[model samples]
Target: MKSRKFYISVFILFLSVFSVFGQTRKQLEEQRKKLNYEIKQVNSLLFKEKKKVNNALEDLNDLNRKISIRAKLIATINSEARILSKEIRVNETELKELRKKLADLKEDYADMIFKSYKSKSQQSRMMFLLSSQNFHQAYKRLEYMKQYTDFRKKQGEEIVHHSNEVQAVNDSLLVQKALKDKLIVSEKDQKKEIEVDKKHQEKLLATIKKKESSYKRELQSKVKAEKRVTAQIDRKIREEIERANRIAREKLKNAPTKPKSVKKNEFILSPEAKALATKFELNKGKLPWPVSEGIVVRKFGKQPHPSFPGITVNGTGLHIVTKQGQDAQAIFNGSVLNVLVSADGRKNVLIQHGNYISSYNNLEKTYVKKGDTVVTGQKIGQIFTDKVSKKTKLIFVLFKNTTRLNPSSWILRR
Candidate 1:
């Protein structure tokens, strides 16, 4: 009867541990699989294109990204192994304790049966009860027999319950061992991948060192192109702000009902524009990507260049690089302001979002024209691809009135 309580406690403990440890490891394994798939994509799409162009710097960057992801996958595998080890140890202990308890319960049940068999005759039971000095004592004796019978039945049930528990724990232990073995194999594979990437990075560095001057010149040209586009974006935003303010001032002067003053760097906004601005602000950090599939090669703000010790790249927006022929989409609903072209003939489409503006540039061809309204994910243009470098990159910018904002902060991270 006492062993029954112990069996219930063991089952409850198993459930609690399974809920925490088992579920967490399961989620980790799923995440590891997704990371592996992304790494595979990098290998096929990014690294496999080096034969067509001599982009040693870009190649190194891709290799570094894969190495980082491999390290994270290995770390997750190690965590799963540790969690499985803990669960296995607890299960083994529980199994051993249940076996001992089952044996003790069976022994007590057999002894009770042996004694009861000797008093099985009705005459013996009657005499035993009659030997009590009073009616109350006789009633107490009958109650004792009933209690003993209930204890025997409970002992038999506890033995069966604990036997099943022991078997279940043994089975679970086998599963834990299998999972550990699989993780061990995965960890070893990732380690080999990291070693391979390190060799590739070293080779790319040597290649870069051989053509240092030419590489620096190429970097300078790229930086100049980006600066040119950013200047155009800022100029366009300021012009639009001035134009809207001028219109608002004219309306206020001619209204005759109520003349009002207009503020600098402010645009005349309609009720619909005001509502859109509020909704856009509320959706910050949750906005969809401009490109369906792309990776950010250059982030916003000034950061030190990877090759040059003191050289820094001043960035005004996110530079998303994708495969050739990929289309650039609008991140939010807006009307196109202008589709400006650079001196080199690359096109950029500017879209107005209420009092804000977003620019998608470095496009070879644009689909949307001036004064056309566009919704989220609408195709704005096809991104430009450099024939020499075989790179398709886009420069995206945002402006509130005349002040520039980081486009990366408003969009989803991945």
Candidate 2:
């Protein structure tokens, strides 16, 4: 009984290890799928053949993004390969042990069968029982014979079970080895693609360097525009917060209850608004994308300019590039705080989820107006496609009242 319990414990431990391995393998597969999809989106949206004009900066940036994702995909494949290698090794060891165990069981069973054959005659077994000195001795001899027969039968069954286990482990080892080989091949292909993209990136960089002055001027103008848009967004959000607070204060003055102290820059929330805010917070890292399908071309925070050394580009939000004519969607349930129009006629729609806000920018038309309630995945407006660059990009930003948050950290990875 103790031996059986020991075997069961070992089997459970083995299963748990494989369970963790399977989960990790599944996660890596998901990451690979997402990376592949993003790469396809980048190629289809940014590298269209109809984009006749040569924009060196944009081209370089797009190539860089592609190379980066390919590298990540390769890394993911490598990780999966490592896992497969480990599994294969473990399976091989188990197969060896199982085969040895099966061999031992067969040998022992053969020995038992040989002894049983030697005492095959029923008359010989009866004579041995009759040779006992007393009735009790004869009874003991009979019971011993019965137990020997049962033991032999059990030995045969164990041999069969061990043989089957050996076969199963051998088959598992073959599958793991094949998967490892496939991953190795995939990693090689990704490396080759990265090499080609790097060459193209070099050419784009050289072209930019040749016309350095013009490139610098273009970069400065773009940077100035980014700052202007950021300022507009900040002002609008601040104004919204102030407006909400003012309304809350007005209601308090007319009511019998004492007014609660409020912060100057933050929102004062009612019970319902507070609940909505809590829900939004709980759903962090699970929010949907502003567009159904898009690639983040520019991320939030500060990074050195890809074209020029020393100069840095500060981004206040994520710039996601998608197919032309794609409509922007609300990531969560919210009310439209305001529709902001920039000097270039591009519109930005801001939606408020209690104190949390999501902003979608670079739209040519607006579908929902201020004070309109929007549900998750609701289409708010159409994304503006640049005629010159031929890029359709949406700038998405998130905030907690007056605090800026990284959109990447909040949105779903895919």
Candidate 3:
């Protein structure tokens, strides 16, 4: 019984190990899969315009992201392997203990059986009990015989139980070993991939170094392009504000149930628009991203360049760089305010949510027009992908009436 208790304790301890680390392994596997998919999307961003050099910066960024994810995957694999090894060890030890316990139980049961066989006749046992010195002694003798019979039966049952436990432990050990072997293979594959990626990254770095001046010029042009889109967004937002203000003033001039004063930086809203705006505000930091699959190559607000030194980049929105031909989705239920085109002919869709507005700029084509109501996650437009630079970047901006809001604060963290 003492040995059984010890085995139960060991079994419970091993169970907790699996319960904790098994969940960890599953989560890591999911993360690894998601990162791999994102890397694939990033790779597809490279446009197939023949005779044009790929954007070294964009390629490098993607390679870096891939390398980072692969390294994490390798680490996760090693962690899973370690846990499996520990599990195997624990189960193997338990199997040994169970085998020993089963042997002891079986031996005891066999001894009990032999004694029972030696006392062959029921009449002999009865006569032995009847020859006791007193009534008390006879009763004690009968109790002892009953206890022996029950104990022998229990021993036999224990032997069977321990044998089954041993079999289960053996099976578990095999499974753990197989899992460890698979994880090791996966780790090796991840390492090989990282090595190949690093080599390519080095080659790209060398190429950029040889043409540093030209690359720097290209970087400047890219920065300028981003700034151009940003300026267009701000300008369009101001124009919308003026339009809304004009409508509000006309309403105030004609309506008898007018408010005393118009609130600053807030558009005049109908009751439905006010409710939608409240809902949008309530969903702050939880809004869906404009694109389904992309990376935030440039973040909202002022920040330093990823590769360029001493260069400051500023934007009011999150810049998601995605693959070619990706459609922009509306983040919330709202009416299309306007579909404006930039100087370079890239279109942008502005959707108004009560006092708030969201702008998806740098679209190749618009799918909705002004005054058209759209639902959340509805397709609004296709994003513009630059043919010359092989760049497909989206500028996503948010606004509270005329005030610019950082889009990073609103979009979901993918």
TM-score of each: 0.81, 0.86, 0.79
Give the TM-score (vs. native) of candidate 1: 0.81
For candidate 2, list the clashing residue pairs, or say none. none
For candidate 2, which ten residues in a row score worst on lDDT? 1-10
Off by over 4 Å in 3: 1-23, 43-52, 120-153, 252-264, 321-323, 388-393, 402-413
lDDT of 2 by residue, 1-414 (tens): 122332353345434434333448879888788888888888899887467587887887788777767766776787778787877888888888888888888888888787777877545888989899999999999999999989988888888888888888888888888888888988898889988886787677678768888888888898898887788789878988998888888877878776667777788888788899999999999988999888888889998876566678987889898999999999999899899988889999999998999999999999999999999999999999988889999999899988899999999977
Summarize candidate 1's per-residue lDDT along 228-294 as a digit string, tens digits: 7677767777787787667766766766565334466766776688888888888899889888887
Candidate 1: stretches off by over 4 Å: 1-31, 48-51, 110-142, 251-263
How do the residues 285-393 of candidate 3 rate in per-residue lDDT, one tens digit apiece?
A: 9999888887876677787654555667787687788777889999999999899887778898999999898988889998899999999999999998777676778
Q: Regarding lDDT, does 1 or 2 come out ahead? A: 2
Q: Backbone clash tally for model 2?
A: 0
Local distance difference test, per candidate? 0.78, 0.83, 0.76
Candidates 1 and 3: which is better by lDDT?
Answer: 1
Q: What is the C-alpha RMSD of each candidate to the true structure, in Å?
A: 11.2, 10.6, 10.4
Q: How many steric overlaps are in each model, in order?
A: 0, 0, 0
Best by lDDT: 2
